[model samples]
Target: MSIHLFNKRTALMLTLAATLTACGSDNDDNMTEPPPPQPEPMEYSYDITVVNLTHEQPLSPITAVLHADGKMWDIGMSSSIALEKLAEGGDNTDFISQESVIANASAQGPLMPGLSETLTITTTDELATHLTMVSMLVNTNDAFSGLTNLELSTLDVDATMSWHLAVYDAGTEANTEAMGTIPGPADGGTGYSMIRDDVDRVSMHSGVVSQDDGLMSSVLTQAHRFDNPSIKLTITRTK
Candidate 1:
């Protein structure tokens, strides 16, 4: 009877030990930790600065866009209605809202003659590889200046690229420069007339023939006339 009692106690001790070991193994599995967190994707950014190089023509609110494809304006092609709206009235709302635009920005107000404006644009999207900028010459009829479809992919971060921009005629309106046709403070005239009365094509602008030069009907004087390279643009990749 004593030996049987001793054997029963031994069996109970072994079973308890096995059960405790199994429970410990299960607890270790449950206590395992998760992996570490991941870092966020890097953002691509740029700083764009525009300096009005003209003597008198105040630049309209500048419109800057980062896009993948398509152009804001072409030398030979007819200007889009959106472009016309901008070149004619200094309104950039439709130009920057186009479908091809990935990211866009605009200056708060007109950049005065000999003044400068800076704008920053950023995106995580790798597809936004092209840049375009447009702004009208408020003192001229349908005259605009800026870059179009400029490639940004090759530009390295922290590097800068700059160019002197020439004026371009939207050709959507005649360069009459009449009393009520010019917009700026010079005339306080009508901004946009959708008559399509010009050459109907885009071309490099012929410097204004202000009244000081001839064009007796022109509301502008010699101070309002500008030559090639009307604006200076500098672009820097920040990230």
Candidate 2:
């Protein structure tokens, strides 16, 4: 009888131990927590259209940028090498790579007179609240047209703004319009020279005086001449 009672007590103890072990296992299984939340996404986008209004000059491929806050070209300030490059050769390589440029886009090829090109620039950074657009009148010497540091923060999605951009002299070259001096089809001449030959300050371009207009050495004709408001620029926020 004592043996029987000992067997029953041992069975009960074994069952209790097994139950506690199973409970501990269940507790461990329940301790797993859920994953943390993810951050929200952000995006901003803009569509820019530039129309070449010149009678004959084909604009260099357009360069448009969305930045935080800074002027690429300010009147009375000397032109950056990048600006000079673009103004002279229509090469935007250095201009688009500016440190202040948050996002940028460019036209595929020359923007011919009476033609328009539209490009879209997008960024995940909402801080890019300034827009700049630049292009060279390929038929002249250091003549460029564009808008700079125009405020974009208040522009709502789908909203639009427009500007008739005036031409500006890059001030890095002379406007002699001489043979082998212009970079366009008229001469296909040298584009940029490091020497600061002209008035070394940014200023409104006193329109190009072609060969027909009395600049005797000019390779260009009256058809290449241009005045203020050379480009019709329109900007629309897309996102």
Candidate 3:
């Protein structure tokens, strides 16, 4: 057959398939004829702003992932090994590439205390409807800040959404704020360890009890301590 005839035949088959899938829905009733082939999916873009509100803790480079179905982290569960790397070492490369994510972005440097940073992610899938933001509070051990399973459907394009996010204890490492365990400016010590300590499951951070607050083994002073909602996150659907 001629190329034009073959093309027409292929388009006719696709239209038939789509009509069958619609199964007499209202959409099918309206489609009396086949429409032109669709282009690739449109991209959805968003800007995520993270403000570090701690007294002295510096946030590691922010990790933002866009997925269709689920959260990257959850409370009362042991973190994934990828999460352990990000939580303990401020490395998001592995976490964002985890199979759970469809699209991802990360900030370049630490968001210092009282400072802010913005990370942007774009997805071509309309199925991408959930957001998860993650970053480490690098002055301590296994303490990280961010949100999981933040539904983004109700938010309209060009509208802004904000949240005061809480911190979490990644149950991969011990919270011993000793002299050489922290990996931030406060300690410049080691990052990931194979040992599992503390409650072996994720939970709300109890806030740091530094040396000044009577954790005798904690090398951190009052300056290294922090409370809830350490990060102010504002998300705007840019496109």
> For each candidate, what TM-score against the reference?
0.83, 0.84, 0.82
Give per-residue lDDT, candidate 2, residue 215: 80
lDDT, residue 31, model 2: 46
Q: What is the C-alpha RMSD of each candidate to the true structure, in Å?
A: 11.1, 11.2, 9.7
Candidate that would win on lDDT: 2
Weakest ten-residue segment in model 1 by summed lDDT: 29-38
- Residues 1-239 of candidate 3 have per-residue lDDT tens digits of 69999999999999988777677565566655447689977778999999999999999898898887776778888788888888888888888888878888988789989888888899888777899999999998999988888888888899998999888999888888998999999889998877777677888888888999899998899998788889999999988
Clashes (backbone N, CA, C under 3 Å), per candidate, total: 0, 0, 0
Highest TM-score among the candidates is held by which one?
A: 2
Error of 2 at 161 (Å): 0.8
* Model 2, span 69-168: residue lDDT tens: 8899999999999999999889999999989888899989998899998999998887888989999999999999999998988899999998899999
List the candidate 1 regions with Cα displacement exceeding 4 Å: 1-39
Against the reference, the lDDT scores of all candidates come to 0.90, 0.91, 0.87
Candidate order (lDDT) = 2, 1, 3
